[model samples]
Target chain A: MAGLEDLYREIILDHYRSPRNRGELPTPPAQRVEGFNPLCGDEVVLFVDLHDGTVADIKVSGQGCSISQSSGSMMTAAVKGKSVAEARALIRRFKGLMSIHEQALGGEADQLDEDGADGAGADDPDVKLGDLEALQGVVKFPVRIKCATLSWNTLTQALDEAPA
Target chain B: MTAVEAGRKAATPLDVARVQADFPILARRVHGQRLVYLDSAASSQKPRAVLDAMARFYETSNANIHRGTYQLAVESTEAYEAARRAVARFVGAPDPRGLVFTKNVTEAINLVAASWGGANLKAGDAVVLTEVEHHANLVPWLMLKDKLGIELRFVPMGEDYTLDLTHLDRLLDGAKLMAFTAMSNVLGTLTPIRRITDAAHAAGALVLVDGAQLVPHVPTDIAALDVDFFGFTGHKMCGPTGIGAMWARPELLEAMPPFLGGGEMIRDVRLDGFTTAEVPTKFEAGTMPFAEAVGLHAAVEYLGALGMDAVREHEVSLTAYALRALKERHGDDITIYGPSEPAMRGGALSFTYKGIHPHDVSQVLDQKGICVRAGHHCAKPLLRRLGVGATTRASFYVYNDESDVDALVEGLSDADDLFSL
Candidate 1:
């Protein structure tokens, strides 16, 4: 039996208990994007403020399971002061982390390989993940992979809608 | 003895261990633990008899039904109609000719909405519904309201999680139809179908009962209930998927147009026009699931041998046990949603634990091989009404026993330990 400790790490529980950057940002200065897992009715609402090629501020407010809310919390903390390009790279790296075991599970590895590689051919493999690496265990449970990536998907949408 | 007294006297409890043995999957282990399946409301595990009947149909009498004059085809047709007859008798319908087989309950309800509602209803017609309906019952009427400029009114739920009938008279006033569920899939709230049908008939309206959750768990008598239409699926009652039934009054079935046009549903077809078939065949369009029908026949026979009254009695006692056990073990940390009385509801128990998200709770329980559904349960409107995103639902069936409930309760403590913070 696969242990629950693999999925629910202590750090993940801590993040779930006290989510970081958990609130709403004003709509006028912040671009908002919402992501929903229709399978489970989990929602992730993101508000992003971009200025001078940097993510000036970001906040997450939504209701979901522990993996989703904790992932959103970690995502806001990671991208709060980073450049947009850096955040996009981190998104690629984080998605790579989530999909690694999914590929091993005989899923659509080819399509994910294509999606993971940007024009740069690699997502800067040396990128530091910090606490985000804890979510890599979510790949063991494939259904929950979406829960972990929901916030990042919403972040991608927010970046697309945010003014450059 | 009167029928009620006889029924009560004959409500012998089921031998759950033997019943569990009839389902092969219950013996299988999940995650190195006993598989405690509590998600029967979504779909049930098929017994050995149902599985064998379906295989036997394909092996012995596999042929397209209704048209062929050959030996195998005739046998196939007989078996299919016999299944229909068995299901009709099971639900207390007077005639099998009024029952039409569709893919599932959702399709069954859609047939009524599109075929009957489309032909009979016009703009400004009102359809009264209740707040406790699954999306299968609610969305069809909503689609009709959009297409035909009709009005839809809902009977709200009281604080007790049952429908508040205080305004039912006003809601049914001048309505063209009243469509609702006999049992709620989310909260396990059983509606008073006979009373509501009486009111609808008195108000000069038709009634359609969504029996997807009701017929599987309790005794259903469509004729006694006096409803115009009754829809339910086979998979939730220990039968295979891809087969469901809709029973309607003969006159309504005769008056309604065919839902899907195809080979079996037509009497004759020409380039200019075509004539529809008789009542039941008029609605059945394609080469239907004959094997699934065989499975359903065996399933109903299995239930009949066990007796639905006994099944209902067993669930009532089991639900009462679960309700009390959960409350006693968890105390205020748990919030179960539904009517408190087991007789008023079925075995579905939707709850929240220690303010933890339902998904997380279900994930932890999964480690212990406990299968419970954790989601909006296709009742988003009702969940929104309750102001919760989702709930963890543990529903019981004929095969489940108190041991499964014990596993679930023990598994919750595991969840609490990990996510208590």
Candidate 2:
């Protein structure tokens, strides 16, 4: 019953309504990458500027459902100042959080608590997920896990494509 | 006789109560509410008859077809071929021999693209297609064009949402094939088949009709329509998944190469060169989905017994009612796509509610046990043409009634309130 509430969290809706880093950056120093979820027609064009082996500016532009659009918005905010390696590390952390939450929720409980209930490895005392952890509940809605991770995957690809 | 007794004696054509009885899923609840299933355009719910038919086949005649000499295998082969014949007659094919069983409509169209398209379409050859085609029809042709140098000319959409036939002659001119959908699954626009077929013929181009949306809703006669190849899936018409059919002209079937190379499609086994089996068998590669085919046969019988005309009649009335009910309640807040007239379309209705995104609307509806499809609906190009990211579509079937429409309207109202607030 609370699954929809968990999915469409107030923070998620706010990001969806008024997204951050919502436009493209020029292509000279920026590498542009596109991610598409053909099933739902969701797409993200992520622009990243990597200078001197560090991430300078990140911008996201696209149209999609709340889950995808909001995740893209949060992703830009979380990774804007981090180095390319740090951004990749955050991607791993977020994906690990989603996987852990998925295992905890099981099939019957399609909703996760605002904070990880079983603490889902959060008790490690070293995992500080920041704003990106808001997406941990996305694992409850299994179909939309792709939506929550689309931009991060695209960012990974963008980094891989860019030269060292 | 009493009024109620007299009314009961006449007997409705659909006997919806009886129809509902045939689908076991209809009896189930969703989200603690009555399951008002309206997502048939995505795929139809199977009737008990189809399910039983498949189960009975597995129980009685469980063997590989076309290879074994045992009695069970012969029975399996007959059942498979009988389903083919049933599908052929259901679509009013001039001859059942041209029927080729495919996995689904997408596979059927792909078979044509690889087999027929690859053979005939050389460099500089042109193919005409409409803008409203499902990705299943458009993407394969694009892939073919990428492999072979060919041109794809599109028929533009009119402001009224139907195909603008004014420039159709120009599009078809010099085109080797005019491939289009008989009905738009997104907009519910029933494209004029006979007119398009005639124009394509006059332009000296063969006609290929994607009947995935049309055959399930209307009475189809391939001979009368003068189409070269007609493609459709079984699941959209109360049949099971994993089975579909393509009715192509006998000559075209004979002329094209085998699409998939496998054990069943070849006549002689030689590593250097193999001779292909004839027509339908040639196209049917590997062991067929005979159980699903048996289920599809039962579905065809179910529809045939109800009469396609009656099915169309029931759907039109229901669609018209739903349209009026939705518009009447919402007024200008609702924007419905495709043709406004029910006669000019099928039961599928695509629309946006209260300027809320279709995904949001569908999510809200899902909470209420009202099933509807949202997103590009496998017709992304069409949605882009319409200047929308996605649409929420509620399609009607034989078992759907006025109450289902009411539930849909109620669900939309809930969605509007949830978003607007």
Model 1's DockQ score = 0.83
Distance from true position, residue B112, model 2, in Å?
1.6
TM-score of chain B of 2: 0.96
Superposed model 1: Cα runs more than 4 Å off: A100-123
The alpha-carbon deviation from the true structure for residue B7 of candidate 2, after best TM-score superposition, in angstroms, is 21
RMSD of 1: 2.0
* Per-candidate count of clashing residue pairs (backbone under 3 Å): 0, 0
> What's the CA error at residue B27 for candidate 2, in Å?
1.4
List runs of model 2 lying over 4 Å from the truth. Answer: A49-56, A83-85, A100-124, B1-12
- For all predicted structures, in order, the TM-scores are 0.97, 0.90
In the range A75-119, model 1's lDDT, one tens digit per residue, is 999999999989988887887777666566654466456556333
Worst 10 residues of 1 chain B by lDDT: B5-14
> Against the true structure, candidate 2 has what lDDT?
0.86
Measured against the true two-chain complex, the DockQ scores of the candidates, in the order shown, are 0.83, 0.44
Candidate 2: RMSD over Cα atoms? 5.3
